[model samples]
Target: MSEFIDGVITEVPQQYSPAGELDHRVHADDHSNDWWRHAVVYEIYPRSFADSNGDGAGDLRGVRSRLAYLAHLGVDAIWFNPFFTSPLLDGGYDVIDYRDIDPVFGDMAEVEALIADCHSYGLKVIIDVVPNHSSWEHRWFKEALTTEPGSPAWARYHCVLGKGVNHELPPNNWRSVFGGNAWSPVKNADGTDSGYWYLHIFDSSQPDLNWDHPDVHKEFEDTLRFWFDRGVDGFRIDVSHGLVKAAGYPDYPQHADRAKRSAGGEIIDFEPLPHWDQDGVHEIYRAWRRVANEYEPMRAFVGEVWVDTAQRRAKYLQHDELHLAFNFGHVGAKWDALDLRERINEALLHDKAVGAPTTWVLENHDVPRVVTRFAGVELPKSSGDGDENESADDALRRLAVLTPEQRVVGTRRARAANIYMLSLPGSAYLYNGQELGLFEVVDLPPQFRQDPVWFRTEGKVVGRDGCRVPMPWRNEAPAYGFGPDGSTQSWLPQPSAWGALSVQEQQGRADSMLELIRTAVHARKSHEAFGETDFIWRDDIAEAIAPGRSDVLVSEHGGAGNRALVVLVIGTDPVDRPDSELLVASQPLTDAQIPGETCAWFSLS
Candidate 1:
């Protein structure tokens, strides 16, 4: 059993003030003792995990059954995607109720059981909470639509009436993520129009709640308490920065006059209207923090801050906001050593600036799998050279010819990327199936496509469903062990060629991608570099390891006082030249190596 610390290292300072610095050290005594700083969170999409019953959908029981597997995987916490009562619009982002679990997944009792089971395995549970908006079918919205404009329910949402004289439209000009308008017209039950429209910011079925209302604030506070009381460890808040919008609802600079032409033309901007930022949103967060503090000391609250700049991202973590905010700059970055080093340096510096913990993720439900995104390798195409080239009938044979040596080299590069993410001084989130080296399955048929992004963009955007397919458990099992026992189909079909990457098959192979993940995770837990926050980049050495040199070297200076840990990752991919070891090898990785390959580890003595 792991020893429990009263408080884990939670905060990393931007600047060192030897004597008068803020007590950024996270100890058991601090109110916000965020344990997530050192956690390795594994994300699970309920629909794709294992299904307990034969209902063709995954459920809480399915998750409960997999506790042993997760616990054995060495993850500190599990971040479950939304399983709350929802219309399934936007994949459960449109919540109809905040307190109950969706019957399709299971009931509240089953969720409670899952929580209990996870705790039994020493695994903390962090569930997704969509605080920005709720389904149009939510009771509050139903009441707002039926009640008079002056009623309490009416004030709970952002509703504005159009003025004929002024030509007033939706409060502002912010665009919805899924495209189109951020406001939907509301009609009263009496057959007369309410004249006022509600703000959505996403799908029209999801109406954004007004934080300016005391009742709305109370509802969320209560909702959080409801889950906290049920023993939930924490929350991964969805669109956390979007809670409170500007009060007056002002117009933004027009990117274009029409929807098709504007940069963010589809939706309306509602945040800069009035005093949105200062309008009690922080107060609500502080209140939630107070309640969270009353429970387990290390309880965490992570927010999704989708801002572009590090400065703006730091604002969300300033004080009493979120314990950790998701950093996306790295995920969106192109695969370049210099670019990665700069991004990492920037993120670490930002964490110190905010005095709040930071979280890193390479892949998530909304993004493509990291293997497909970060692996700098391309499969050789069929050249029709009758002698060496093979046909579609020889696809599996072609796959066989693609040597394990090649797979190892490619996987090591990916593993090095994982090392870079985990070695940084913050919490790291591992999306489901990422550890298995899963690639994005773009072969999804049009009929089975569920992502709204695909429909809104007319397929211009590939959408995120390809990454949300069922997890493969066994090599030969139907639906890759995601469906009912012996069933061939699943809620979403498993990727056709995923059998070779199944967990069962990889578990037996010492050199499989799954083994690499296990090794990296295990090493992360065992290394102080993964847990400690003092990292000073060795600029001279870092620049020397940049591309065209065949290796990437990164050194971090810090340890008690004078000691330092230097990590060297050697690339063996085709892009990297052979015999290109510029610096004397400090520690050579025993794993496979190919041209342009990469391996990671630190030397600390």
Candidate 2:
């Protein structure tokens, strides 16, 4: 039998000769040059990026209009969130059709145009592909539900039979990333027990397909080929870990008593689930790698592995698996210099052993904005004393607390973080609006909340809607011109103070956060060390910071060179020293006596 291994063509010889004859040689050169290893990826949320049509939402045309802006940013690639035909469930993660573009986004032609335009501007386009599950409205899922259990279409999915049987029984103890039961009861149109249930790792609306099925594998392979045929550069796989599951779904062990509350009056159960890091996942990834190899230029597949441990995270990046797995440890770490250093060191060491690159991200549409998470200071409510309605004075008072110098310090800390992430030897992902120092919207009205977690978690999680607010494009236009019409309200409301943070205002102001981002990106592009470089952290400096104190992180980068590029990050809080060698500060570090917030690049020589 012939099998494709990691996109390489290999043939099994019927019999081995006494002299150890070779059957076939795999094409080692095909998968060797992966551009994502040293590229900077900029993530764009299609619905909020720009509006080409007068539909109040962003479309492909809108993205086309912004090609120059992205090219100007100096990122090598753009990872567009799914613009495929979807029911808008889970923010387009519930893909309805893998082949067609959503009507709201544009037609298939428009997508191709966007890709062509991006390529013309020297930018690579990577689309988000949700293979773990599909929208219940997907044609295949609909056919599976309607067709007989033994039919081909039925076999294409994980449809099982009998109430509480394979269908009714819980797949295992695995819990959905979103809170609640992972299984959804399947019923026939006649309202009787179908004698089986379906597994949805996330929402009931998203039915997880069984990858163990041979036909299912073939179907996805064809889908991958379809996109490759369409000239897509790569795929940012959603929930990359959920492609495979344990043989039998088992119950996850409860870490703490749900009936009891902790000192913070919060239910605390943060233990690891038994089946999260399953062994079967590797096989599925290897299979995807085989499919990716069939195409030229070797398409990239970056996975989102949400594990806290470095070893488990590194496992996803094993040579035959994904090109890069999200290094989420950095994203989840506290905003302390020392903590960041430890996480980066762990990632660098683990990836070096596996001979795989890492992907770094500070913010994403699915999480709270990094600025809000690390700003160190919280804003006061619109109402000064917690009242619903308040005068403009309350807003002014809140703004007053965040002085220009404080804002500069905060922005600088963020810039330092960016320098640390981009300078590392891996692909770096910059979330949309991150360049503009976008913060999470403080309060979202009930009607404005779109995240399912808000409903299941009872508002305790704050949901992801705050971070999904529309991008601010212009300062004077209504709603900052994020919507199709300048006067139209965006799908996701613009943050209250977004008018002041518009792209136009930032572009005009040299000192704006947008300019700072542009400078950093250009710096990364101009430096040869940033591309295909190796990181080497100073052991003495790393060891100096206290284990628990999250201040002052330091790292050095060198690859076959006598001199090294060093980066020093200072946290928002005050530093111990009055003066030091300021290599570069994201924003001006007043505490460090840094002249400006701009990143200062220097040669160790």
Largest TM-score belongs to which candidate? 2
Candidate number of the best lDDT: 2
**Prediction 2 global C-alpha lDDT:** 0.67
Model 2 lDDT per residue over 1-605, tens place: 01101111111111111233211111123333677887889999898788776576888898898788878777899999999888886788888988889998999999888889999999998888888888999888898777655567765556654334345555455556566667666677787656666777787788887777886777777888898888898888888776776655546655543233489887433333444556777888898898888877888788888864677778888777888888888787666655776787777777766777767888888766665555556455543342233223223222333445555555566766666677666778999899888876746667877777656555444456777788888775556877545457777778557888878777745567776667666656565445446455443433453234434443444333322344453533333322233333355555543332233333443
Q: For residue 303, what is the lDDT in candidate 1?
A: 82
Summing lDDT over every window of 10 consecutive residues in candidate 1, give the lowest-scoring window: 4-13
| Alpha carbon deviation, residue 484, candidate 2 (Å) | 4.8
> Which ranges in model 1 have alpha carbons more than 4 Å from their true place?
1-33, 148-151, 163-171, 190-194, 254-280, 375-412, 539-551, 561-595
Q: Write the per-residue lDDT of candidate 1 for residues 202-243, one digit (tens) a residue.
A: 778888888777877788778888888888889998887778
Q: Which ten residues in a row have the lowest lDDT in candidate 2?
A: 4-13
Model 2 TM-score, all chains together: 0.81
